[model samples]
Target: MTSPFASKLRTNYCPSDEEVAEIKALLVEPCLRLKGLDDKITALQKALDKLTQERDSLEAYVQAHTALISPSRRLPLDIIQEIFVACLPTHRNCVMDAREAPVLLGRLCSSWRAVSLSTPRLWASLHVVDVGRLAPVHDSSSRRLEERAALIPEVTRTWLGRSGQCPLSVSLYTFPFPSDPVAPTILETLIQVAPRWQHIQFTIPAAFLDTQFQLAAKDVPILKSIALHQYDPFQVPNLAWDRLEVLRGSNVTGVAISGCDLVLPRLPLRWTELTALSTLGSRDSPVSGERHISSQEAMELISKCPQLRTLSVLFEEHGLFAETEAHPIVHPLLQTFHCRGNVSTFTFLPGCLSLPELKEFTFLVHLPGSDAYMDDENGRPLVRFLAASSHLESLHIGISQFSSSFLQEILRSFPPTLQRLRINAMSKIMWGARLGSSLDDAILSVITPGLGDAAPCPCPALKELQIDRCTAISDSALLQFISARAATLKRIQVDFAREVELDIRPSLQPFIETGLDICITHVRPTRKVSAWEGLPHAERPLLD
Candidate 1:
């Protein structure tokens, strides 16, 4: 193994001080050169930073310029249309103003204007609440009403035309006491579009339905719903259509006649096929001379309309169905029934009307000063009916006062599947000062579901509760209840509670943090009991 470099190899080498000094001298020259190289690196780093700043500044300017003609301006027509649809207002109150919703959306720019104009749904819902209030171009006070009436036709015609072939939902109201009679032209304009009407709600003057008036309901093949509200009692005219025919069953399924003036014989449409019906001022708002309808007449109406699914009425007299007590009026498909009137209205309901499939019940009754909700048997029908509705899910109660024991009993008997409960406690001359906070305390007890012996939590499936008016609940009890049910209770709306406004929120924060929707409003109670609490025999009460 004789290697090529073997002759030059050296062994056992060690550095001497003299030899190390010479090596150090050679390294000093290179170390000195390293300082200059570091300085050069710093200078280059500063230049790079400056270049980076300039590049960023230029890029920002480019982006700012590019955004002027951004891709959004180039969005597809269909996407822009969807955006316009999304911008439609989500409110039902009707008015025509330059600042509101769809109109506002149209006025943004030319492109938006075209898109809004092309959307039929945007213009299909028109609410002209009051003829006099509709702003007119002319400003003459003496001629204001006349001028507005004159322009009504033009405005309505244009609005309806914009809807193209869409079924119309029109709310047209005439002046209650017109200083000058409304022109015939306005009525003519509306009647012209009767064929396309699907939903029409009217609050017109009594004279508007005079014998001379005529409607082309014969052409309304798809007229499904119509509501007529009246404050003054007038005989609903014998409305007639030349010949009403439809491709299928009667398209008109919902009817609302406000006054008893609308006798069954006077009604023009098919009553047997109706799925929803409402009548107000039945005996509730009767003039001095004319208020008709006995328990017999009302019972007869109900007997004939076997298919009615939803019924909301205000009955002034009790025992509207007593004559039919022998044979109950059972509506197998009825799911929602709301009735409002004095305590007497539902007194005789138990023996007569039976709605087996009803799921939601609402009763707003007045409080008689001397009467008790439970002792007087005013709530018997309510309790009896709710006890029977095994599938009932929602309850809306607005009464003069909510007694603690009374509410507890109702909740205890509420359908086990109940999910939404609304308690609106309106004032009624103190009705003896409210058993203060007892009602809310009772509620806390019911919902809290006490120890090993007490019944299961009332409304165990309840996810929402709304309590408005009255001062039955204080902050302390509200917090305790919410904290206990925070896991299952999803939302709560408590309006006009002073104590809750002052102190409940801080305690509620823990529940809210975990996803509880809670609202507490502070409102000073105004004394309007005189307006709403008038006895049925007393002067006709006007709402406040």
Candidate 2:
């Protein structure tokens, strides 16, 4: 059949008007009919969409009912508890955040919240930052956040309450002094839980802690480890402190005190029971005319601490110990001793103590402008000390400024059994004479060409090596250092190797592939600021 909308045939040379009209005729009615069908199709699509939505709703309802009868609800509580324990904070996330671990577990069903809350260990670790230092505002317009002081205590209460009777590893820091109201409130709240505190770090003023020691003494049957700051060494109370026992017939086992007056005789610490003692001098602030500890007093403490495993002392000035040859206090179990101080202090330390088991020793001598490598008062004593500690496996020298001959002399005298060595050439406090610290050639010369005994490598059993801020060393020297010990080199970390002209990624790839963990951070050409340290909770890292 002929289509009606097709153009009509014209017969005449110039077609009549009627013929032209027929040719130009419109299909309006047919088009209108198709539009009606399109409208109908649109209505049907809306209906289909409505039906799909209803079907989806019904499917969701069916799944909900199915879930109610699911076998997962019958999972044993012990298994759920194990899963909850696994969800607790890990090392990478040392502080618990709201989206992680116990907090995340609590956000689930009621049963899960109950399991998380009941796990005492989950709540035992409380890491808090000082609230007072979070926002410092000195204007008269906005008063210091005195109102938020109550918030700290409330949170502390909730954590301690949830912890039940579990022993706590709490780092409680309140910055500044007793002036901050939040400091006192938080301290008061923590003291209420004194019996449960197993390991604690309190960096507040000594006044805040004075009463707590007595409170802790009464109820704390085993206060094993403590780190205190802003201590007044001479403030040791005259009362029969001996009666205040921290452990079961033992004093606190491990202790670290910083920024305190130096008076060993009046220390609240019990020297006899300590396994680790860290008496670090304060570099942050030094008030002249304040009482200081003599080398004689330091030796006395070491002599008394028979069970001490680790001892760290940083003396600011020369030690004027009265005796040149004090009776050598033999430390049978001493493993690590880190000493950082002026030349005279280190010169006197070795003669006072005999450590048979000393394994790691670090000596960082601050060289004054007047000092020389062979300073009559300083250099020879350290040599004598090195002779005494020939058994040491690890030795670190922060004082890199030395005459090469002087360093070679010391290296030659190193114990044959020495393994791990570090030369930190970038300590900020070390002044002058680091010109001879291009240590690669000197160090490599000591090692023979073969592995272990075949070569006379200073450290045969050396498993790990760390080189930081050694810009003078070439890539060849550093690589050769590792290659010499490839058989025993399990790990190597090169920090701030700026001057070296090798791409670490491609150059060290083979060593990495063979099970070496290599970390290289190229030196930044700018200075970096120190991280915040005022509060126990670093920068208010509280769980939100």
Candidate 3:
């Protein structure tokens, strides 16, 4: 069998030479196809390169043409200066981060740097809240002070030199420690440059007075407004502020002036030229006893500010003194009075009664002792004072402690000229035996008569009313009263306690149904009620 298979295999195998040649030919055909593909790729690459070169040339031509037609010069000097001024901050911050502005503008080119440097107003307002933060550690404290002192004068000169008599505003605040005696020298330098200074604010610590007396003594002739904090006026004796229009003193401890005692000298009388003055007492100061401003002293100060229009005084305690006498005659030109603290009993002097220009008054009253007076005795004088202001437009009274009768008396005393009224958090009951009766009924009865007839509200000028957080008053009666007088009422806000039901009435249903600006602010079930919540969200906030 093997011999026969070998003969057959040899016969078939003899024809394989042609088949091998055919197989070699098939392998060579694939190599030839690969060579054709390589040729196609080379041609495509050359075409792509030629197209890229042409596109680049076209772009360059277009760019050159565009540059030829467009303006190549820089913006006008005036326009550049205006842009730079627009970049400066308007707010008075203790520290100014303006170091980058000058450097960046300067680096734009030599011309830009010159323009930026030449613009004095851009650099004139030098605010140095943190000298250390602005300078490096290697610069000694003395060197920093000298540098800081020199900044104002240099900038002032630059501004005056460039702008020629343009108004300038300068603000400086230093926190120099007692050991640093260079602050006074710096302040003296600032005063010497004060002729061009329009606005100056100083927050120097009390320690600077120990080093140099001139820190507080220098006279500022062109200074319109000066804000001094933690400074002793006694240290600087000849400090005559002639053109000073506004003077603010804060945390002024211990130091006193020979001519001016504890009480600020009456502006037009003692200082004569003062127009607006503000003396803010710290929260730590005593409210009662001799430490408080005497009623006489307060009157004297008020009288001196002849042209005084606005006055704001904050007391540490509610009642400064237990005086029943009327306040000293206030300035006739006074327009606004803001008193913050627990002053339960206040009497406006006879002169304060007829302030023709008075428009707005805010009183924060806190009654002391259980037997607080009602009727004319408690706060009728203030009410009368308010009533006398024919131009009175808005009134805000915060009554912390008072009886319903007293509140009623107060409402009765309200002037008919009042356009807006607000009653803040006030007690619902006090004095004698009306404790069990509904506080709402008592308040409504007191206020109802003042609301005028059912046809027209009592306060005809009254347009907006807001009531908040008087737990004793029934919302129904309050709303009913408002609805009857709704013709003049525009907005009503009712913020009530969780436990209290509004007890909506049928008459007030129309106001609520008509979508009258009525809002009911309910106290969050788990959260505590805030005093602010008790306040009516109306234009004029009231005490009750």
Of 1 and 3, the candidate ahead on lDDT is 1
**Per-residue lDDT tens digits of candidate 1, residues 1-544?**
3433345437555657986676577668678889989999999999999999999999999999998899888999888878876766655533576787668878888878998889887787777634454443466873666665657667877877888888877776655444444434555666677788788776665455453235544667788987665544344433332222221125889877664345545566577888887765323223411223433455676777888888776545543334433466677888888776554455555456677888888876643553434422455565777788888888887655445555666667788888998977544555356421234555656777452124677788889988887476667777777777777899998776443345667778888898889988876546556753646777855664
* Root-mean-square deviation of candidate 3: 16.8
RMSD values for the candidates in order, in angstroms, are 16.2, 11.3, 16.8
Per-residue error (Å), model 1, residue 67: 4.9
Local error of candidate 3 at residue 337 (angstroms): 2.2
Give me the candidate number with maximum lDDT.
1
Give each model a TM-score.
0.71, 0.69, 0.50
RMSD of 1: 16.2
> Clashes in candidate 3: how many?
14
Please tell me which predicted candidate would have the highest TM-score against the true structure. 1
Deviating ranges (above 4 Å) for candidate 2? 1-96, 99-111, 133-150, 176-181, 210-216, 231-251, 281-292, 316-327, 367-393, 412-420, 427-441, 444-455, 497-500, 525-544
Task: Give the TM-score comparing model 3 with the true structure, all chains together.
Answer: 0.50
Worst 10 residues of 2 by lDDT: 282-291
lDDT of each: 0.65, 0.64, 0.53
Please report, as a residue range, the 10-residue window in candidate 3 with the lowest summed lDDT: 251-260
